[model samples]
Target: MAISKKISVLLNLADLLAKNKPEILRKNELDMNSFADMDESMKDRLKVDENKVDGMIRSLREVAEQDDPEGKILYDFTREDGLHIVNRTVPFGTILIIYESRPDVTIEAAATAFKAGNRILLKGGKESFNTNTYLTELWQRALSENGFDTHFVEYLNLSRDETQKLIKENTHNVDIIIPRGGDNLINFVTENSSVPVIVSGRGNNFMYVDDDCDTEMAIRLILNGKKRISVCNALDKVLINKNLPELKEKVSDFVSELHSKGIDVWGDKKAASIYSEIKETNDKMVLFEEFMAPKIYFSLVENMNDAIEMINRYSGGHSAVIVTNDAEKADTFMQKVDCAAVYHNASTRFTDGGQFGVGGEIAISTQKLHFRGPLGAQELVTNKWFVYGKGHVRE
Candidate 1:
């Protein structure tokens, strides 16, 4: 399809969603009412209000306004034998995205793929069946209005056994698989998918406070990082420098702040020693766990190196941050932290595709294979080589 046709489809989808807000909310409410016993984070992801629908519309329009990612020339070469070669961006054909809840993904994520000229096969969790189905119907409507096939955006309401069989077998032609959920889902797709899988790993993001950092800024950033408990970028751990000024007093102040916000503060032995209010945990395995809740783990490090080592060892390879005033130290930390995004004096929550000005993202990719960081429309395409010759043969 032409770029204009693709943009028209996205714009039509946005308009349709805007006009169908009441129906969309009704579908989401039904899903929410049936799954009342779910956790706070799960409920948050499953719920869809006017604001969430507005966000979906905004993202779709943003994607439509941006330049198409496909057909961009990457390289061009010519040989003396009258042969020409060119490499250009091309769609990945079909992308199967399996996600849990977050009905917005049915709109926002699929917009990026559709804008990049790829067919999207959505496989949302059972909890979001109604909302996902309704949203996908809007997508199909937009596609049909543009004189395109409705199969371009399809929703698969499959059972557990059926999904597993499809994942293990290449029954449906899928180019890439993106699993955006917890470890169990990611592991299942990565282990069973016959096609390439883009693992949108856990959060478990970390932040380190340098001895030379601004105490107030560090505290503010840490607080903001935990503001959203349902996102993959939420802060889960903190590694404080042991030599920070007034370390004990500062720890107490931070702990008090966290408590005021109803956020649970867990601490290691040294961190607990600094303040008795910190719930102490001696288990080493907690460092690797992604607590998608109102909980954060705290530990003390000897210096920048120790902090860097601890973050690299325990983080989910998603995002890491260093709160420091020292430019050189911040640079070193940003360069050394092995994550898709590293921050200096900023909250890990800012590591998002929309925040980074990419409009919408298919997933916040943590793996290093096809691409890293936010997989936006531009990153969704693969390069193809085009060769031209007239009765040319190689000797």
Candidate 2:
């Protein structure tokens, strides 16, 4: 913690990072193109392409250079006995972040930790080892340049066995563990890790087309929501009103187009004639839940009440969008949907850090405790009370 030790650490990390920059950039360049061309499975595992990764680092640098998330005074109160209570924000100190194939997550999580004054141990998806290593090196370089402890951003370059060992053995040193991946991966980390967890749950976002929705705008919004279906915020479900004007003509045409583009469609018997492209099975429930990204389901509902019930039954508690020109209708749907974020007149895909005007987000938090939506550095800090009082004897 000494000034000299800090300087030494920063300098050494800077030198190591400087030595590795060119090689890292070269590797990233190759990854950029190859990753962009990869199929849905490979792309989903990586999450983002290289150009986006570069943009992410830039965004982090800008975010870090801004005012700190900590150092803010939240509240102050005084008592009649000359006692004062002041609430101030502070960092969690040490955090462990476990995530799947989104390589950019390593840098983003590290930046949030750095801004909050916490040390981070990152365990990224093995599928993106090469990408993770270089990104971690980039973040270390940034930390060194800022004269912060480079070791504050650590990584465990190990397989499943070693990862489980660290989680089991170093629980005491870790103040919190954040899991940022699929349901199974997150469940595994949360169930097994001895440290407290900030779980970022998986998203199966929904999009509802209300009777008041503009048909042209609805098509555009739905396409935008599902264009990048691999993302956590991508629209996974589409709900259409059973009795919209030209309901069959407008929605049916749009749904058919989606099917042509490889999206699957499922729905009630009323919608069955429109979505024949979706391969159905004898088991209705099985077909309804089984979504492959281009696939969407349409169900005819009598009113907003039915739509609300359907959403509650199917939503994965991440993001939901309601397309309605009517203000009251939008409000009703938003109120009924249970998720981290709800949208009106916009694509569910807009549920993102940058979209919300934050420079970047650690991840979309589905948990209610520390954070609930797109999380920036401000979401990374906890609060403490500072009390002051004059001597007063008890009666």
Question: Top TM-score: which candidate number?
Answer: 1
- Model 1, 39-72: lDDT tens digits are 9999989999999999999999999999889999
lDDT of 2 by residue, 190-300 (tens): 778887788777776777788877888888887787787667776666668877898768866787667666776665666666556544433445322424256666666
RMSD of 2: 4.2
Instruction: Show where candidate 2 strays beyond 4 Å.
Output: 1-22, 28-39, 44-50, 281-292, 389-395
Please count the clashing residue pairs in each candidate, in the order shown: 0, 4
Q: Which 10-residue window of candidate 1 scores lowest in summed lDDT?
A: 164-173
Q: How do all models score by TM-score?
A: 0.99, 0.85
Which pairs clash in model 1?
Answer: none
Error of 2 at 195 (Å): 3.0
For model 1, state the Cα shift of residue 13 in Å. Answer: 0.4
- Whole-model lDDT values for every prediction: 0.93, 0.70
**Model 2: clashing residue pairs?**
263-294, 264-294, 264-295, 264-296
